[model samples]
Target: MPGARSGGSGGDGSNSGSYSGDASGAVTVWEVVSLLGKLLGTVVALKVVLYLLRVCLAMAWKSGGASHSELIHNLRKNGIIKTDKVFEVMLATDRSHYAKCNPYMDSPQSIESLVFNSFS
Candidate 1:
């Protein structure tokens, strides 16, 4: 036992590239899928809510002027303000009404509102 080697193991290996730990860090596939799903859900929810709001708004009327004040419209009608811009945007689709001022949309469209009561 005088010529015996000690602690010798097969050190043969087959790799020649630089190495580092996996960069996945903390996030998982499920996490990625869930985040994407949440984003999609948010987009869907926003579209649905906006659609419903537009539908509801279309079905209703504004008692008070929204963007333009009632007084401004009156001024326009009386040619004090001169509603050329309003006439332009409004008459873009309505063509024939280009020169005419919308008494309703100009002052504000008249609308009926449905208020839901949550009485138990």
Candidate 2:
């Protein structure tokens, strides 16, 4: 069949669909499947490692606080909110009113779940 490899000998006594690095000059179907499975596993493992690294880097900037003003103060101290105007604005805004959880933590928060769902 077209695009299919047969692991058998041809009419001229030559190996058909033979893979390299084997003295038998023939490759089994199970070997090909196993090799593909290993390749897929490696790719998935690498993706998981990359995702964990990204999460760690994002959480590195987080500075927990007790309240809105304290959170803004921490941000300024950490050189995130450089200008006084920005600091005042952030202080005036109550994160608890918008964020569903961890309002004082310096991290991205979703104000409304529906908004994100709409975008998706």
Candidate 3:
């Protein structure tokens, strides 16, 4: 045949070049390893972010205030609370709006005396 190779000769009449047995530009082992490393790093970073978020939420819960009240409500959904009165009162009253600066902090806030005097 016109394009056929002779015995022990390259089909194109060239030296067949380096690694000529497989020359389809296949991915190298290093490239595969690098890709896996990048993927693993990304997964690890995502897990770290998720863990940080959980930590922040836990801190918020312990610190109390509006978020603490909401956490209590969520716990009640799972039957953690024996009654709904506490949740209902917390829902009816927004301590953050009623207080100043970090309204959610667990502490007694003073109300304006004028409002209190009105009740007198």
Candidate 4:
């Protein structure tokens, strides 16, 4: 009787739908909860992807060894690099000029072909 007005009800005389403060509050609360749930889910998914990436890197590291190809494979497989230019450079340059022994080793070798020019 408080919210009811007399004449414009439905044909059966039932009151039309009405909005209440409590109903609006409930809707707002549910909206906030749903947003927070989505945000948290996204964060969890990102963390899982990163964890998987780290695991893949560790596996590749264990299987990786000395050799230009293996080194490049490890670098490419673990997402350390995204371009093919590294391969071009490695292939274009001869390691024998830089490395005295272990030319195919992954570690850096001392420069054996340095040309010192006296500019005095």
Q: Write the per-residue lDDT of candidate 4 for residues 1-120, one digit (tens) a residue.
A: 798767757889665668544634466777789999999999999999999988765553342347756666665676654678976676567665566777665555676354332222
Per-model TM values vs. the true structure: 0.31, 0.44, 0.36, 0.33
> Which regions in candidate 3 have their CA more than 4 angstroms from the true location?
1-23, 61-120
Candidate 1: lDDT of 25?
Answer: 58
lDDT of 1: 0.50
Clashing pairs in 1: 61-111
CA shift of 103, model 3, Å:
13
Clashing pairs in 4: none
Worst 10 residues of 4 by lDDT: 111-120
Question: Can you write out model 1's per-residue Cα lDDT over 1-120, one digit (the tens) per residue?
Answer: 888754443346433335433445567788799999999999999999999987665442333233335534444454444468874553344322221345335333322221122232
Candidate 3, residues 1-120, lDDT tens digits: the string is: 898667665867776455554457788888899999999999999999999987665543343435757645654554444476866776677666556566665445676864577689
Best by lDDT: 2
Sequence-dependent TM-score of model 2: 0.44
* Cα lDDT for residue 12, candidate 4: 93
Residue 39 of model 4, lDDT score: 100
Cα deviation at 38, candidate 4, in Å, is 26
List lDDT for all candidates, in order.
0.50, 0.80, 0.64, 0.65
